[model samples]
Target: MYGGADGAVAVLSVAEEQKHLLAYAPLVKRIVRQLNSQVAGAIDRDDMEQIGLMGLLEALRRYGEPDAAFGSFASLRVRGAILDELRRQDWRPRAVRQESHRLRDSVRALTRKLGREPAEKEIIAALGITAEAYQEYQLAENAEQIGSFDELLQEGMGQADSAPSPEEQLMVRRSLEQALRGLDEREQRVVQMYYEFELSYKEIAAVLDLTDARVCQLNKGALGKMKATLQSA
Candidate 1:
């Protein structure tokens, strides 16, 4: 419901609706296949594809049938639907969410005061947290930051759907571009390889000569910095 020409779609006969759904069925499968490859052991591919198909049906109902422009518009809705379900099934407890907020706020405050990103030791001191606790915070931060990166990638693809005007969309694009430009070269390459090139984490690691976990860390750090910059804009 974040956006769509929802309710503005022209009503169609039952036969027409079925035909359109059948036509877009492949798109749902394609999306599920890509997401399933990334999260192989975590979610059932069949279930994800079912959800994606349902999402496509809803998009048809609310945003109308297939058109040249409908694919990108429906793509956003389908992704949102899947991500919403994923969030509902998230394993994080309430306390973890709270701690992430605390860590994020502390880092933001420290950055403002220090006029630079805070070091791990400085952050530990600022938050009066143990090294182990700081590491936990980092894990929490990575989860949230990487989730945000998905939405950011969608925006970059011109698939943003918050009902912005053309001028507003332009500003958002500029802000995101500026934030991306601020990334270090390695971080930039990591992001591009993962998103634009649609490479798996393992594949990106092999190309970058780093471990899979290191690639995730680099991406997390890069997204964190871009998030801060984007918020300021």
Candidate 2:
């Protein structure tokens, strides 16, 4: 237990730091496990664990008494830290990222012109690509944009030095929900199943009676639309 005066900013004793580290080691492990399953082959689990531990230490160092539980706040910080590292070490090819951006722009343009979420066929036609080429593009874009939930969660959190207030968090959640509402029914289901339920693409495909490639395409398209909506909101 820390023996310092309440709410005072002071250098923690080595023992105090170690105590907090030991106490939160399990939390770090749990976060690493959850993120590991989402990020296969992109980054090693041990590396993520190390990054999570650093985040835990950072949380302990900067944390203040707030209405929210320390664990909740720490979890956000830990996950944010891990995500920061992932972004820093992003290995997606430049061409893939460019193509993904182009696809997103095309979707946004078509949605504006159609005054609704564009269908998959409409998107393909807007991009002036064959169905087979569109599938390849979707697969490539999906591969590059996979595991984007981190960014989604961190959207309104602001900087680490100024963690989001409870009200801010609530507003962010509401914004996310509203953005999701912009998606079509099928796109909404795909997002819920894949992210909320943590289902694999193959599993979601089976449940939705769509091909695996189609699921990936829908997932990427839905995410792109949500992102645009959130940004506009």
Candidate 3:
């Protein structure tokens, strides 16, 4: 249990707390940097560092034992804290969020039709918009949203500095595959097409002959199971 600030803490206890903070400070800094990059300048390093410090305090409060792998717990806490901050910012307009499904569908269709990476011009044409209007829409609607193809894939299939390492990437892929393997074949294909191929949920629903809500449920359920399995592993 954490003592109150006014309590007279022992010197050795204070020293141990200082040591723990010293050891984790670098990790917290790294977390802040990683989250800052992921946010694409929406929030700066210092802001994220402040949020990460709060996460560290929460982690320390809940950490059960010295040998209980604080780093992993702290990692999740920091990420959660950063995401909470982003949510509090309300970065996306509600209209944009509502239209994102349609925009994503358009993007997927345009990409599939082109059989290669579609240029912004191609995307605009497919969406039937003037270049100026498309640019405005992109700026207004898609600026800080996560989980899009352009953001997730990075430039030309290369990972960014913020992306996971090769080993972690492989582990994630294997974990996903294993989780999918346990699902019904149809559900597996639905998830693969939607996520791996960058097809939108609408496209997946159309191809799978299911309602959009059903598709969403299946995808969410599968992903939740996959997350649980990976975390356990």
Best by TM-score: 1
Cα-based lDDT for every prediction: 0.69, 0.73, 0.58
Better of 1 and 2 by lDDT: 2
RMSD of each: 6.2, 5.6, 13.5
Per-residue error (Å), model 2, residue 10 = 9.9
> Candidate 2: misplaced stretches above 4 Å?
1-40, 64-76, 93-140, 146-149, 197-203, 206-212
lDDT of 3 by residue, 136-202 (tens): 4554342343333222223222333222334544665576567667778777886677544545555
lDDT of 2 by residue, 1-233 (tens): 21243535456676887887888888788777655644555678888899999988887777633334457667777877887787788755678678778877887888999999877788877888888777666666676565465566666565445445556678877988998899999999999887656567767889999866698878887888988988887
lDDT of 1: 0.69
Model 2 C-alpha lDDT versus the unseen true structure: 0.73
Global lDDT of model 3:
0.58
Off by over 4 Å in 1: 1-30, 37-40, 60-62, 65-72, 91-146, 151-165
How many pairs of residues collide in each model? Answer: 0, 0, 0
Comparison by TM-score, 1 against 2, better one: 1
